[model samples]
Target: MQRRFLVGLIGANIGKSLSPALHEDAFAAAGAQGYYHLMDLQVLQGRATLESLLVAVRTAGFAGVNVTHPVKEAVLPLLDEVSPEAREIGAVNTVVIGRDGRTAGHNTDRTGFRRAFEEVLGGKAAARQQVLLLGAGGAGRAVACALMDLGVQVLHVFDTDAARAQTFAADLQGRFGADRIRAAADLAGAAWQAAGIVNATPIGMLGYPGMAIAPELIDTRHWVADVVYTPLETQLIATARRKGCRVMTGGGMCVHQAAEAFRLFTGLEPDVARMHRLFNEACARRDAKLAAAG
Candidate 1:
């Protein structure tokens, strides 16, 4: 039997978010019909506006919602309760509102990171492997945790805000150990000569341009992944490709995370390969829109 369609929500530097397309594809793949909306609280007034939107979604019958940056942590107190990992990560990226009208929050970023990373690396990105990470905010925390779980030997974290980067490093060290974490003293000078490098920052996105790290630092020996997929053809990914590094874009994370959330909301396993196809189609559509606008 065909399932009823539902609604979903996402926010961040969402001016270029592909979530609507991704979910639209999911609904179609699952033989469920539904719509996803791109909600920008920045355009609205504040939390009040966001709360009102959430209420409206409930009234209108949204299946579930996906929360992104800025609101991932903020939406915690507003939620009925959250998953243990979401609580531990101090962030939530997916929310499912049940038939009882109760909301449950989950952090799929970490799990998504691991899934995507393993899919590319084909094994645990263990401690013996050096991993360089850009950005110390939510995505950094999620990836760092995933690396630690994989027994990664060391993590080099860098951010323009040195203090923020140091603080996140300290937290990781405190939880994991000093042996597995360190601050990037030199982004150049082979400090990033690691098995993998990741751009956890919002750089290289729509309004944002430029590589998260120096292009000179990228080489064929390192595996590169960026959490940005708006343009999808981000400078980081492009440079990595030129350097012959295996590249993973935020698109993979988007699909895997949503699939997990879909299972939570529907209690049925998602058709992941089909989800990927839908996501790619939606991305193509977005590119067409941008081209037309230009």
Candidate 2:
């Protein structure tokens, strides 16, 4: 008999996530019986806590779960062990349930973003340039670490929550150096000096629709990247493109990260090109649906 794998994604406002389609299709192609589910917090209506959800899924024979958005940091304490990289980033986006019943947390976000950036933008120029990064949450931390790894000379960090941004900057400064990372008090000022800008917040996602930075701040001199994949072309990306700035969408990160998560869940190398094709197909379907509704 062939083995079967079950996995899920846990997050709020994720009804439109493409993770399930991506993983399930990969599993089918790999000849495994796989079922990927979405455990939307908003849909759960508090019926189960994160702890309870983890327990329920594991008990029900799930192989693992992907953590997202608001729960990425919150899920850390629930894991039996965390990968060193995840510990360093203070976030967990992937959790695997071992056969021995121990759950280990690992973050694939950094690797995902790094791979996407390198693939889309030749790393040399971007690596040498200073970057203005928006947000300091779980995704932000991952992107910041990836940017530093890519050789960004300086990272100007900003978040709506000033204290959160300061704390995240302090943490990164301690790890990298005070010279490499600093919290930004002025968005326009930081963008004026940066060669690139990245948005790692949920601001431009489907449920949350808005640009993280002022459109006027973006110019032809800067490159822009966003991590919100639901609306592949966010207002930020659109604005930056109109200004002739190079842009990277959240779709690449979404596909790359899902590829890593697929490997962790099934221990099989997924065809990344196929995964990208599937992701693009899913996005097209989403866009078509929205267009029809409109």
How many residue pairs clash in all the candidates, one count each? 5, 0
lDDT digits (tens) for residues 1-294 of candidate 1: 878757676565686776667666667777777677777766654564556766777777777888876677677888888888887777788888877778888888888888877776655544478888898887778878888777778889988898888888887787888988888867774244688888988898877778878888787888888888777768899898998988888888778887887777667667888878877877888868876885
Best by TM-score: 2
Residue 178's lDDT within candidate 1 is 92
Error of 1 at 55 (Å): 4.2
Worst 10 residues of 2 by lDDT: 120-129
Report the C-alpha lDDT of model 2 over 1-294, residue by residue, as the tens digit. Answer: 776999999999999999999998898888888999999898887597788999988898888999998899999999999999999999999999998778999999999999999988768757778899999999999999999899999999999898999999999999999999989998889999999999999998887988999888898989899999877878899898999989999999999999999999889889899999999989999968866875
For model 1, the superposed segments whose C-alpha errors exceed 4 Å read: 45-48, 58-60, 124-127, 288-294
TM-score between candidate 2 and the true structure:
0.98
How good is model 1 by TM-score? 0.88
Candidate 1: minimum summed lDDT over ten consecutive residues — where? 42-51
